[model samples]
Target chain A: MPDAIDFWFSTGSTYTYLTVSRLEQVEAATGMRFNWRPFSVRAIMRVQNNSPFANKPVKMGYMWRDIERRAGLYGLPVKVPAPYPLQEFDRANRVALLGLEEGWGKPYIVASYRRWFVDGQEPGMEPNLSASLREVGQDPARVVGQAQSDRIGGVYGAATDEARRLGVFGSPTFAVKGELFWGDDRLDDAICWLKHGRLVA
Target chain B: MPDAIDFWFSTGSTYTYLTVSRLEQVEAATGMRFNWRPFSVRAIMRVQNNSPFANKPVKMGYMWRDIERRAGLYGLPVKVPAPYPLQEFDRANRVALLGLEEGWGKPYIVASYRRWFVDGQEPGMEPNLSASLREVGQDPARVVGQAQSDRIGGVYGAATDEARRLGVFGSPTFAVKGELFWGDDRLDDAICWLKHGRLVA
Candidate 1:
């Protein structure tokens, strides 16, 4: 069996969107089977005692510039979303959970990221998401409805609890077997582990 | 007078240690005086709705790993300090405040970072700090005593409040004329801005 690549992500994360764009190509080239796992960003933050943008204006300013630079480097268009945190992740993540159940998680993640990052559409923005889903031949309303079901809720909760149990504390995180790789920047290292069964020293 | 570069920092931040070591060379090369300003990481996180560590085991795992990589990249010897966060920053920060007053903040920052990143000492670990101070011909006990004064405390508070007002959320952040740049990775870009007055498109 191919090594399982567990992808833990958040819909509102820009880095997650970036990683989603390239992960498939890496997986195909490396012969790794991806296991898409979506979880709540808020639930994980509670355990770490760290607020994401804590009191450094200079740093936040740098992030906008750096993300744009990285996006340009990756040939992706970047747009700063309104209402900064994009609180609509509730519905987006719920739908993603349903996608996981149907084994459509990988495609959903890619499409969602493309819509948000490449197309500059917000994932929580219904019209954009619906259109994007339809383009991918998915029934938007049905997928969304299924995302809100108790079954999907249970999946979301389980993924979140598992994240805590596994000591996950950030987005764009990946795991190979049991070894973990954090940040969008570490994707190559994750692939290395999957391919070699040990981290590069 | 040259445009002042705001050095946004936190008392307990590690990346700041690296930046401090190089600030003088950067300033001499670019001809800008860094306005050393300290801020609280806690306050910035509240506004961004981001916890420092977002909930993914891979992220937590990668942080330590990434730091090690960065230490190697910078040619700094690093040891994970005891008790992780090193809670005695109040005293250490007070000393920094005094150093700021004495116009020795730059050296103090460099020495402190050397002690931690190069010497593998914990922040606020007295023996290490004292030795570091002695290396710079500073009397550690006298400096520590001075750090406790009302004036230094006032400056520390003001710097923290200033950081919140400027929308700073993390460390080793750089600001030039109120333009904020977050993260240690952005130091080069910040220097570019210091020299060119804007980012190159």
Candidate 2:
């Protein structure tokens, strides 16, 4: 087992927003540090041929409603700034990758989600993405230039491929030892499992 | 929404086993009474053309492992009495309907899960189903006879149809007012939502 939980997340995953926003609080509460991994869920879902909420209006509707309720419970807001299930997440995710190497990655991810879901700014688009990067004190031009580099692409693709190999069917997965716990709902369990050895007899 | 939470569940659903086993304990802890409605998730999933774990070995693997961990968390056991994703749940569900009408429904459901997941007994099988009915102090032959009647079939079908109409995409969902919360993970959120209106501004 790893010393830290590997939090596999996606740039466009609605629930990943919750995990990013709550990361600091959860760390403080549980005394556990997470290895924040930014990966391409769209590429993963493509391989699986599964789009859980795409073209499924009822499930999509439930997802939005569930997010709103969860955000409320977590003391957050959902402005729903831009259209969801957004397609162009590569830029945002790459920028997140760049931010990570420079120690601004976590806050950049949180700021991006706040822009997309809380602050009425479209994510992965011009101006909004740059503004989110700047909020965490990174020079947008410098960070984004590096983010769009071939080097960033290599690491980003590697993370997604690794996620697939781990049998991670969805975003916001927690992986430790040989066990994979998918979805934000299992976050607590993952933490406990990491600490208590599955709590089974 | 309704005065009490409508706990829509399927007898064969793996997660529903957790909900059924936890029902009384949850009610006692939260002081919330549940309106248990026995419905066919197989019928609902068929209408959606979805079998989330069918032919999806990875997800199915995660589910059983997750259930075992949860059973451990809740101090229960998964004896794996019979093959999972059992196909013949209609007989067991019909008996549940009959049990409910005679005020033994809740315990019957719990006993049935205990038999299926805890004890080494196959659900919907001859001796097991009869033994479950008798555990609730009901006449196995008489209850199963009435359960097999046209009226039970009618109500059973109606509940399944109602679940479909309610946009219930999965089993072990909690429906409150006009909102629907899916999965056992949302069970706590559903209760909190019922008690305190969403907890958001």
Candidate 3:
């Protein structure tokens, strides 16, 4: 079997920012391929009823500080978006699906993550999404128009279902074989698993 | 100021079991004091409406596997109790308060955690609670009786309120100064923060 890891995230996920920032380095170090998959985190949260950011004020305060602290440690710049979560991830994910298929997923996804997080821009907005597409050398008009089609919507829905099937409750989930490792911290463990099979005592 | 970290947990918390398992080594290494405080995690979860174990089936499955995986990595054995989350943590917390006050807090708390998670025993039961107290060199009847008093109940209530005021949302939260590091994964970070203060880079 080929050595591959599934990289699952949503455009709006905070922890995903941390994972995406250093993902290329991890890939290079492990000499492994990453299946960059984007899905709707809001849908998963809605089903789970666990949006601590919006519900728990105390956790929300700590999370912002934790993100900044972690980002600094990783040597990456992060600025929390103006309106957090930017619930309209459908438009951005639609284009992301196309990008993943077209071999520009890495750059397109990273740039869009920067747009939403580092630059504090809204990915759901046309100018923001189109700019990311343009940077990845894709025709902005063609990609944007194609993303709005029913076919892309169907593909996006299927991807969310796949995430649920794969037991992904949170973002930045890394999966090797059938074992799932959730959150940014587990990236190292997942990479280790990829490099050297299951952990044995 | 004394170099101390607030060790926060509920008797029924799974992740807290992981932290309590290795807490002594961390204390020995850092030469830091831990203020072991037990509170009702169920009450906090109710306020947040984020109980994935009970609400989200997928998450609950993943959590068990994750906990077991982490426990193995930490060189600690874990056995899931008959009924997870043991809703009645009042009995355990009451006696735990007395344990903390009497300075046998570390052994008392670790024994109680082993009873619940490793031995698959209930903490709220008289037989189980009494056994833990006796193992810690305390008179079972006296400690049990003292734990049932109105004063201890009041003290336990105040501790939960203090946890809320300190912005603690989850079990196994290690707090130093005003920074809150939540979850078992954060224990290392909290210890590092204690040993080296805050990260500036």
Better of 1 and 2 by TM-score: 2
lDDT of 1 at B189: 63
Q: Give the lowest summed-lDDT range of ten residues in model 2 chain A.
A: A79-88
lDDT (10s digit) by residue, model 2, range A1-201: 355999998888888877888889999988888998889988877766667777567677778778777777788767542367765689878878778888998988888888888665667776678888778887877877898899999999998888889888788999987788988778888888888878432
Tens digits of per-residue lDDT for model 2 on B1-201?
344899998888888888889879988988888888888888777766667777667677778888887887778778642367775689878888878888999998898888888775666776678888888898887887888899999999999989888988888899987789999878888887788767432
Cα shift from native, residue A27, model 1 (Å): 6.9
lDDT of each: 0.69, 0.81, 0.80
Show where candidate 1 strays beyond 4 Å.
A1-5, A22-35, A46-73, A83-91, A97-107, A114-125, A145-158, A176-179, A185-201, B1-5, B21-66, B97-107, B114-125, B149-162, B188-201
Q: By TM-score, highest first, what's the ranking?
A: 3, 2, 1
User: How big is the positional error of residue B144 in model 1, measured in Å on the Cα after superposition?
Assistant: 3.2
Candidate 2 docks at the CAPRI level of acceptable
Error of 2 at A7 (Å): 0.9
Going through the candidates in order, state the TM-score of chain A alone for each one: 0.87, 0.94, 0.92
**What is the DockQ for all candidates, taken in turn?**
0.19, 0.43, 0.49
Q: B192, model 1: CA deviation in Å?
A: 5.6
